[model samples]
Target: MDGSIKVKNLTKTYKGDVKAVQGVSFEVEEGEFFAFLGPNGAGKSTTVQILTTLVKPTEGEIFVGGINVKDNPEGVRRNIGVALQETGIDSVLTGRELIEMQARLFGFSKKEAKTRAVELLELVDLTGDADRPSGKYSGGMRRRLDLAMTLVHNPKVLFLDEPTTGLDPMNRKAIWKEIKRLNREEGTTIFLTTQYLEEADQLADRISIINQGRIVAEGSAEELKRTLGFDAIQLTFETTEEAEQASKVLYGIGENMEHSKEEVTIYTENGTQFLPELVRNLDEQHLSPKTINVKPPSLDDVFINVTNEEKERV
Candidate 1:
């Protein structure tokens, strides 16, 4: 339970006055699936790079598994595994060769390296293609191999940056299952960064969203979604006229009543409790909706709201 990661006041500035990351701070508890959610160039990669010792931070402190990164970068590296956005495998090498080489680099003996390589290939479900040249592998296959290579040393903390990007649904789900297994069974701390909202929602125990080089919001997916503090009730009508009429009828009942061509959405504090009243009010006005749906706010909604609010301030 001591394999936690901590970052304090992390900042990184580049040439040409580019602030890639600014005053970011967060903590990942031991054995936690922590997600960094953000769009491209939102400092997600920059933060990961700094954490993994691929880049030095301009200012701040970083600790992995309770070892200070700046004080002992090699120690930090020893405790963590990284699967970056780009695959760095040698295509001419077989998948087994790549994993064996990684194990060797981590100081495994020749015999031990082969044993670890076989274990990892099986763990990633690439045992069948272990001897295939990486150049002949598909994109998904290559990704899985890269992930296996990262695990060759049994790292206590794992960093995955957009691990499922460009993968088909089947492959993405396969990777998700592996990641969950690693965290659940191995007790490895996972730090994942991705723009996929659903990925973060499904895999992360807690999510921190970055925008414009700063942390915009941080919470569990449900907590962040509940920051809006309302449920949405959507009403679809046969005509725009009906939607407009329905909006007037629901004017004071819900906040932020929105209407489009043939749909209306209202934000209510307690949508379930208010739904019946809403229906009765609309029915009294002869404005029955074609369909009604009540749903809790989603992580995507929270992301959009937080990023838009940041944009407006800028």
Candidate 2:
């Protein structure tokens, strides 16, 4: 598949010399679900804004739908749809009104715009509430309406910035279903930025995790998880001091060893095979763990492992 979105050496700086985005580069293939996974203030939104033409970049190249961003921002805009985190529909406008207005703004004729509005309301499963004022709709309903408005013009590429943030589980699932269908059925390339670990792991075909303005890790969920090459054995001690001491006593026995408060997590190959040896090490050091559990590497671990620069290693 061709690259639907391409970004190269992209950098953005604010007035105080703070680098919001630093030489970041990645590409999203056509009809692929690509996620920019990061915590807040990690430049996910900045990068999205630049690609959507709402904000200009300080340096590097960008293209959307085969159009150069800098040379033809307007042309790029025409081919893309953006649904930002905040839903800003007018309180008095009904769901249908919001969608119809959006379709008309994109140059749809009066009759065509009305027909398009009805189709979108059904698409987002809001046909039952089509005529209800947005202010009266629940949070999930409002979010769905905002999403439908973005789809009025049938954009080739869709940019969703934290689309399901602050939503309940059912509501988040609702939004995910719609977007997944768009990608599968309509072949729309999706660019999503999210802080939710499960969101990226479940929805993205590939993910790039960013932290402190740099791309820390990039791969499919399974590929990134495999990088750890070990299971995590978590031991909880009764006291923080014991946890700290246990970390030192078991230093070279594990891969990336780290302790926080009363918990020490040891990552190593064959975790089940290493449990007895681990207990012996603690016993020899006169330390006792209150509880122990083992789990495979997850996206949450990948996030924490990459974001923390001072990783304790064997």
**Worst lDDT window (10 residues) for model 2?**
305-314
Best by TM-score: 2
Query: Residues 1-314, candidate 2, lDDT per residue (tens digit)?
Result: 23399899999999999999999999888999999988889899999999999899999999888888999998887888999876488999999998999999889999999999999988888999999889999989899999999999999999999999989999999999999999888999999999886788889999998987889888997887676447889999999999999999999898777689999998887889999999998899899999999987654565567755334432
Number of clashing pairs, model 1? 0
RMSD of each: 4.3, 2.8
- Alpha carbon lDDT of residue 70, candidate 1? 87
TM-score of 1: 0.79
